[model samples]
Target: MVLTGWASMLAVFAVEFLSLLYLGTLQDEAVMGAVGFGSMTQFTITSVCIGVTVGGAALVSRALGAGNLLRARTLAGASLVLMAGAALGAAAVFLAAIAPFTAAIGLEPDVRAHLLSYVLITTPFAVVMGIGMMLSNLLRASGRGRQSMWVLLAGTATVAVLDPIVIFVLDAGMQGIAWAGGVGRLATVALGGWLVFGKHRLVDWPGRRALLADLAAIGKIALPAALTALATPAAVIFTVSTYATFGPSVMAGATVVDRVLQLAYSLYFVLPGAIGPILGQNLGAGQWDRVKQTVRLTSRWALLYGLGVATLLAVFAPRVADLFQVAGPGRDLIIFFCRYGSFAWALNSLFFVAIAVFNNLGYAAYSTMIGWLRATLGTLPFVWLGAHYGGAVGVLLGQTLGFALFSVIAIAVCSRVLRSPPTTDATARVA
Candidate 1:
């Protein structure tokens, strides 16, 4: 888990450089708002991947925990099939949605055209990322944390190495910028494929009936989770609308802040991800008490980690802001929003760990709701407020408020539900 943090710490170097873009320096708030929408083009894809990947992870983790190693491996084969489907969908979506989707962010004509072109060219990479993410999550749940991190390591390293060459030297412009990301993600896919297909060979030789069961299991859990993940990109759509009302700087700041927030989230990813397999296997083994302990310990760790990062942000808010962008007049507002908004989101460690536990314990419904709250319900109103009065700052407040509410409600729910996880696989199998 700590190594995962170290890996994430290293990731900042890559993320900082790749995130910034000029977009012709905020002519109107609408152009600024376009930053969020345009930026989400990738995330809308990634969020879809997350939603889908969670299904794969949940199924694979359960199989791994159940001591059905062969079954788990077979399910991985099924995942390859699903990822192929995702690739086809991504291509079509990009073709159909690129212009209109980019336009909806409401950027100025020139700015929207620039943004749309970037999205159109880069859309193919969405599926490449989908494959990598699915494999990584499968590995994570099977207790191969380092292996999963390694894939990201390769991708981030590739992106870091390629950014300047692609954008400036090759004169790819936004496409070049997008290419750096796409190429890096392609590297991740390659490495992940090696692990899943070449070395492990889990992604070969599938049984159609069993594969259908695997897909069904994944769909049951992932459907709601996917919807939950959609909330984030959807919220981005809403938040971008608000930032659009302000100016590009606000949207720029939000984009920058999201990078930092993602870096922060990598910490959450490390432990819960590591613990998910442990808890799943334990649940599969019927070791309910140990499953309980894993959740508690991971949550404690998450809290400690969140506090540590919050302290660092508080102490070095200005410097942190600078890493994302220049931090001008709106610097104060953006910094406040990002730093505090992250703090609130950070506290979700308890809930997040709890969600992982629920997934393993066969309460996928419990796990799914939090994603919905954060992405859909919580973020929506904040964007509305940010649009009406607060601007970017209002959205930050909305984000923080959403997490705060989740934290409170989750604690209450976790307290009651943690007492008992479902005892049998048959009972737990909602699918």
Candidate 2:
């Protein structure tokens, strides 16, 4: 499951890297900055959908483990509806508020225009992507990881094939990239819908009462999970707004490094999603020892993977900077991260693992609190200090140090949670 999940995430990141690479060839710093803003904003907005999937995956897996297929199906269908609603609502709110938000952040006019165009073209597709993501999570919860993997792989392939044609041949630029993403998401939704609703028959229409009950159950986890998911992007948005003070060059560099980090550590990023079902099912079955073992093994693997990737990133940092064509302060920032700051992710992976545990085991508020703590107290002061002391490089260093500190705290809390007696009620376990 981990390997397939990693591959699927890798494909997604590969497409992102390729898209950025193509854009870098244009040699427009403002355009790169716009990509940065657009991507982060999209992530922040879609986080609600991600949270819904967390809730869906946890409850649906538990339902299956408890031998309640009907409950699982109902939860799956309800989750999709909830996720779609959240996606559309988020996109609409963002579009309506983006002008003032961007103006408040003092984004440069050119980058702001590009950002608006990208968001306008892509926001409507959030529903498609959200529904597809819910189906993928449902598939995983139902032990169809391979099918979920295929759904993402198919979308990745579509983007890879269409990106250049739309961006270059059609001269669509940033908007073209947005269109490619929307079309790719459409492809995934089509495949995922077929697999979940047709082949697997894992989703079903829920009656009014069942729908309300499912929503209540899902909201318990999803609301906190959504807040938890929002924290990272919120932090990034703040960081990006701060970075804008430095220059477009710095934004461009930070953007490339962001893509590289996602691509390099795709395994760590996917670990939570991959292991979520395992943890949920085991907890549902009251297999406390197995759950503990899974946590231990996952932590070990995360550490190993993080260390190995950090080393590779350090070794090839310069080449990566060159490939992205980020020069001056931006280039320096990327190299510094590669050589030093990247190592922080080794510890940060622990934080990710701990979040998975909290979300799946009915301690979701813990995840939310931890996330916001890191985003605010853990992030803002350190980032300010780093930027004040070291400029763009310091910002990266500060963020790394803050995340490392929180990773330790998260793991400590996770240890205590695991030692507590397991919850007996299945619904309460998720609740």
Candidate 3:
């Protein structure tokens, strides 16, 4: 799971970074703007893709828990349907508005045109990306989390090489990047599907009717989980708008910080994702005691995460900043502060254990609420204040404040719940 998170990010950074360099070479502000703005679209696709995948997880987990292997298999069939639907939607959106989205994000003209071209080219293949997501989740739920990671790695390698080759060397331009992305996605999805559906029959054979039932089941689970997945990206858009108040360097710095945060948060993301199936299996088997132990253990893990990661971020901020090679002293300094802010980044991960526990128990509302707070209330206003008051540094300071606020509130709420007596079916039955 962690590897997928990281590899997914590798594709992002490599592509975005390359786009920025290409923009510099072209000396086009619009091009830079296009890359920066296009990120929102990328994030949007990823969030939706994740939401769709989680729906699959929820379905498989529940059906498996029900001790109905037949239903579980049926749910698997529905997963393919969802994948097809997602692909169709993605392709439609990408085809229709890829260029416009870039323009809307305020990309400069030449860059916007370039980005639009690329997005359009790859839009049809977005379905392939969605398929890969579904396949990966299916594997994970079937107790093959390791297989999912390998498939992701393979895709990442393909994109890692192809992105630069197609865009930079081949001079296929922005469109080339899209083609690369599509190729990698297709290869990954094909390979993963072969293993799970054919080699292992890990889930049910996907039939039309079976898939429909799975969709209905998934909708119930997905709404909450999908909302949770969206929180960060929504916060990002808010952060972007707020950073605009301070100017591009600040916005760029914040974006850089966001990228850095994404890279590191893979560590935090790991336990929550991996532990979900563990919790699912145990919950299904009616091992309430195991669930209790796991939740407590996972929460502690979240608590410990901030201090450890934050320390590392503080220590390595400068070195990390240098890696991106953003131009200009001002840009470099902006990135420098972003790296330094890694301390706050680490501290902010406290909610991980809490979130992990919530997700494992299928407590989507609680998870989604916290996520919404962090992204919406927690991040946006503070970033606005930073830009309005202190500039870039203030932005980081505001982020710290937001994280501290959210974490304190979460821990307090969680503690209150923990202090309350545990509820069990047996207890209810006795009552």
Candidate 4:
């Protein structure tokens, strides 16, 4: 499960990083910045849908954990219906808000055009992505993680192959990249749908009332989890907008840094993500000791993993800068960020693992509170201060300080939750 989940997450980072790397190779800073802005903004915009998926995953995991196959199947089907609806709504919102989104982010006209082009092309197909997200989470939660892995591999491979063809061979440029991504996600939706329907089969829709009950169950988890998921990206949008004030160079540079950091963080997320289903199942089964043990052991492993990744980032900072082909102020900022800002990710790993634990245990509201505090109180204030006084380095420092402080808080919260008696309600009826 760990290996498969890790590999899939890596592929996701690769798809984003390599696509941007191709843009960077074009020597068009505006294009790179546009891609970055579009990507980050996409994440922020789809956060609500992400919350729904997470909520569904939690319910599915708990249902599977408690051996309620019928409930699991019903929840999966309804959640898919909800996610598809949300995707269409999100698509419209993304299109309608494009002008305001770009202008608020301080993008230049050329960059804004590229960003608008990318979002306009890809936003509608976000339905495919929403379906894939829900299916992947459900697959993982249901113990068919390898199937989930292959689905991601297929999708990412499609994107990897198509991106260059569309951008370079077809001479489509940014729009081509967007279309390529949409095509890739379509493949994901196909394969993931097959896995869910053909291989596992969502139990069977019991009846309207039962299905609605399952959706209400999912909503309880999804709404808070979605709000929790929003905090980080919302903070990021604010910080990115703040960085944009320094001009496109800084924004572009920060984009490169963010991707690199995400690559590192993906590695960090492997265990936490793997742990989710395990904890969910165990919690559902009322295996409190196993849950507690898993948390402690994973927490230790996470700390070690964080430190190792940070060391590598510090050592390879220059090499990474060259690989990305970044130059001028952008290059310098990437290097500085790699050397200094990367270690904060070590702290971030702990926070993520803690979040996974909280979410899986039906403590999503607590998890949401933690995320909100970290993003708003822990991050924005510090980032605003740094941007005002110090520029890029200061901004990075401020973000790092936020991570450092919140890591402690997150750990404490997880510890408190772990110390409690395990819930006997494996179905998460209360949540």
Which digits, one per residue and each the tens of the lDDT, describe model 2 over residues 332-423? 98899899988986798899899999999888989999999999988999999999999888898888899899989999999999986556
**Predicted model with the maximum TM-score:** 2
Candidate 2 regions exceeding 4 Å error are 425-431
Name the runs in model 4 displaced over 4 angstroms. 269-273, 423-431
lDDT (10s digit) by residue, model 1, range 1-431: 44653474458434533535432222333333334456665566666666577667767777776678787787777766776686567567756876765566555565565666666666777788788878877767767777878877888888777766765567554556677778888898899888977886665556788878777777776666566556556666666656555555665666666665666666664544456667666766778898777777777877888878876767777876665454453465557855676677777676666666655566667766766766666667655665467655776777677766776676677767778767556336632
Clashing pairs in 3: 30-108, 31-111, 73-204, 77-206, 78-211, 87-127
Off by over 4 Å in 3: 1-33, 65-67, 90-115, 205-211, 245-251, 299-306, 328-339, 411-431
Relative to the true structure, how large is the alpha-carbon lDDT of every model? 0.65, 0.88, 0.62, 0.79
Q: Cα RMSD (Å) per model? A: 3.3, 1.3, 4.3, 1.9
Q: Which residue ranges in model 1 land beyond 4 Å of their true spot?
A: 1-13, 16-36, 102-105, 269-272, 323-330, 423-427
Residue-by-residue lDDT tens digits, candidate 4, 1-431: 76788889899888988887777767777787878877887775568777787777777777788888877888888888778777777777777987887676566788787777778778787878888887887788789889989888888999999988977788777777888898888888889988889887864654788777777887887778778878878888777777767766776788898898878878665664577778877877878899899888877876787788889889988999888777777788898877887777678777877887877776778878988999989998899899789887788789888977897899898898888764656234424
C-alpha positional error of residue 273 in candidate 2 after TM-score superposition, expressed in Å: 1.7
